[model samples]
Target: MIMQKGKVKIAAVGLGNRTCKYLRYVEEHGESAELVAVVDPDPSKADWAREAFSLSSEHCFRSFDELAASGLQLDACIIGTPDLYHHELAVAAMRSGWHVLLEKPMGQTEEQCRDIVEVSAETGRIVTVCYILRYHPYFMKLNELSSDPRMGKILSIKHIERVGKDRTAHTFVRGPWNMKEMNTTVFFTKCCHDVDFVLWLTGGQVESVKSEKGTRIFTSADAPAGAADRCVRCAVEQGCPYSAVDLYLRRKDWIKGFVAQPGESQEDMILRMLDESRYGRCVYCCPENDVIDRQSVVMEMADGVKAEVVMECVTDEKDRYTVIECENAVITGDESSIEVTYKDSSVPQEKYDFQWTRGMEFHAGADHQVVKEFIDSIASGELQTRTPSSEALASHLICFRAEK
Candidate 1:
């Protein structure tokens, strides 16, 4: 939690990996932002935040309700809670006179999102959703080039989000987002960024939408014969790409959520956890997983721009590729670079580069930019971010409708 002028103190709710990523902004800009408090249900995470930020024990709370009861005077709060708690946490922070930087999808339902907007307006508090991809430089450039006079105007957009198989297995089929009872649809949990990118590029209201979705694989019928309930005990796991043993044991990555306890080795920690953990479940045997592995949506914007979005969870790599067809030219980008081809035969193609260097940073530095903008807005007394709740709500509405 931070702003530059007067060193605005910020609080954090839900001390997860995403929360830590945003707090990196405060860590670098100590002169501008102050980490006054942190709240999380996990005691270990609370301890980590307290030690890292030098926060007083009193400032570490287990819940937002507890923090509110303490009557702390914080200028802002960053909420990284789960889907079910976004509405309650955001509303509470705003009502308590603190601006908010909330992670998306901001709410699980349209009414919840509308309530966030209404409450922010009602309390005169600012709420910015974390739609970081739209802030990516490659996309920002694409937005500019699409409206160039030489290119004419944007007429339609076709975008695809490839949620690579590893991520699909880790986060969707066997993770927190696997079941409908626990979280929202894959569109909200995973692809709201894609939907919002469409709206931001077109700068128009979605008029109508038609969509279709289904699970292509990872169903019980798709399971290989002799598969065990848990990967550790499975006979066919050695060659399975989705094998938890290969990913968590041999690879030793994506362990942020399953860290080893004191005196525990990484292998032992992973095996012990996976023995009964959902992460170790056979992807094809997850009886409770309801998320579709693929979805396609066609949206008609009020500006007469058509946007087509496809999400594929069975891909080998996770990435977003977009094509913008203008009246005179067509533009395409895949994070690495952008290319434009003139509709006229004699015209040459134009290329712009972003260099694909974001792996070391969060979302290729968009996270830092977004956090900095939030702070700058606070410093300038504007109380607005590029992805303010009102604008983010437009994109979220499309996701909610498409889910229907």
Candidate 2:
């Protein structure tokens, strides 16, 4: 498709917070990219698309079918819908002759992921998976050090993703993703990024994985006595760390998902959302939450480099930490910075640090970089996407195996 104004014309299939962050790239780099259309079932998101882009009602569609029927000429489509919808939306967009930039956890199952790969090949439409760590500065540094000649042959890697208490409660325990059927399991939903990071850093696929994982604390057996069904009315909610009253009402955090209704006050809207929606449910009382709360995996890569990955929702803070041990030196990093220490004695620099900057700090600027590169590739008429569905399948299969 020939884009107008020399910019890559793109339509966004989902207008949630994740897609909204990606759309920021289009707004900031207007000369190279354009958001020609948007689709979402939520009225609040439609209102956002209209105001954010000065879009006419015709340009803001309620579904991908509507957007496709609108006949807007587009070079690409961004699929950031829920996990359950990824395979469907991606296949539809690609079959419609538009290349796709699909969000992570490409599909809910191994069969679905393979089908997406097959369809992308059959249609010859580019499919770029959103593994943000591949673009993040911090993880990029880890990849650099893993391959640095001075660091010597790689040995092993230990990576941890701290999903944290508040986020786990909001997204996994009581949110739309609480049940397996609504979205995928927490492993695929969250740890796909972690697993993919290791695969990228190692530059090899896994031979086998020895893993142990489960929902540790968010079960009925762990609930306290006299706990109310919802946190709004629970007497025990006062001292609870995962209190919805504390996170939503008093601090007003994690409310980004629920926007205020057209004429409703913010306070009244939040109150109504808490009482009427799943967000207000007590964390311990959620028996229907089938997604895991903790996971640990030891992956043996094809090159004999072993990587251990740990994902947990019990941490006080949310971040990723990695340690890569090589023959001559040891490298370590949290999301903020990296450090390398040498084994040689009397070296001029026994140890040093590494840090990265950001144009937009969201996802440590990975979101911005992912969108920027995808748009550039499309605008340049590049046949191969940077993160292809074939490459992403290696990492996805590991998470899918967790079900067995």
Candidate 3:
């Protein structure tokens, strides 16, 4: 499928709703790439691709293996399958001499991640793991600030990622990545990008991680007796908060409404969000609901810097927060003083905010930037690639360790 034009022939392996993110990238930057093929087990999605993206009928594949054996001479393949299927699909793509753009977390475990890395090495093919944060301009600014000498040696860091209760029920308790056991670990699945960002920003490895998780709220008991499986049929649909059908309707912020919010809600918003969206179904009432609703972790970077992070599936909605502490700073009794003494009692405090700055022409999100850079690098043979697979693998190892 090689052509004289600027297009790089590529195949997309998944067509879930999330694929919209990648599709937007292609539509906006189609000159650099072409939808050479579309692969998905779902016939509807494949048909949608043909009609929506002008993909030829011959280009839609029923499975990754079918596409791999198609001899289409593809330049690359993007693997957007569910978390559990990432490693195998990526390996198959790389082994077949097609460059791969794997979604975050890389793989489920360190061993599987290593296997992918080994395969990439053996094939001499590029494997770019998508850790969108690396390409985020806001984080890029943070990195610049950290690099400054006046910042004076970052000694500690704190980060928190909170989601409302409505969100928890939709993604964890009901979504495909819901189960915590095998499909995806919360830390690896949800926070791998952040872990990678920490490593990238600090330029250090995670020496150790101590994490704790629990299902603090959103239980099946909340559902009516025998109202199992489908929440739509349950008589409690109108009364119970967090009803799936209701959540969907209220997800206007997701579909058309402006203030830009995820369909999921934090713990505080659970009750209020109940029956606000379609996700409120008593899905958790079934035996398959196993994802963690709350989690916290503390880690020691290889540089001896200690960092604490908490990701709670809360009932309230708040933006992500990151604060860095510099141990080298001294509080001159007048700079916002809170009287301090000497010895170990003089634990000084100074805060630097790393909150993301809003407004950008193409904040297609960090993941899109990562994909763009990877493809650009591959086409131009630029030696520099942001969020390379090996570095992403290290972050995955830290996450895998945390999950364990």
Give a tens-digit lDDT track for model 3, residues 284-373: 464666667777778898788877767777556634556666554321111112121222445554343323334333443765777777
Off by over 4 Å in 1: 1-5
On residues 1-404, what C-alpha lDDT tens digit does candidate 1 reach at each position? Answer: 34345876899999887889999989999988899999998998987888899899999999888999998888899999888898889998998999999999888889999999999889988898999887777778887898788988889999999888888899898888887777888867788888888887788878998888965588888899998888988999998989988888888867779856789997888988789788878888788888888888899988899999999898886788899999999999887789998989799899987776546478778888888888778866878678889888887888878877
Per-residue lDDT over 1-404 for candidate 2, one digit per residue giving the tens place of the 0 to 100 score: 53334888889988887898899889999899888999999877888888998788889989899988888898899999888899999999998888899998898888889999999999988899999888877677788878999989888999988988999999999988889888767877888888888888788768888889865688887888878989899988988999998999999999988888779998998899889888999998777887788888889978889998888787896888889899888888876667788778544433334334432367778888888888887776765666899889988898777656
Candidate 3 Cα errors over 4 Å, as ranges: 1-6, 222-241, 252-280, 328-365
Local distance difference test values of all predictions, in order: 0.86, 0.85, 0.67
* Candidates 2 and 3, the one with greater TM-score: 2
Output the TM-score of candidate 1. 0.96
Order of the predicted models by lDDT, top scorer first: 1, 2, 3
RMSD of 1: 2.1
Prediction 2 global C-alpha lDDT: 0.85
**TM-score, structure 2 vs. true:** 0.94
**lDDT measured at residue 353 in model 2 versus the true structure, 0 to 100:** 41
The alpha-carbon deviation from the true structure for residue 96 of candidate 2, after best TM-score superposition, in angstroms, is: 0.7
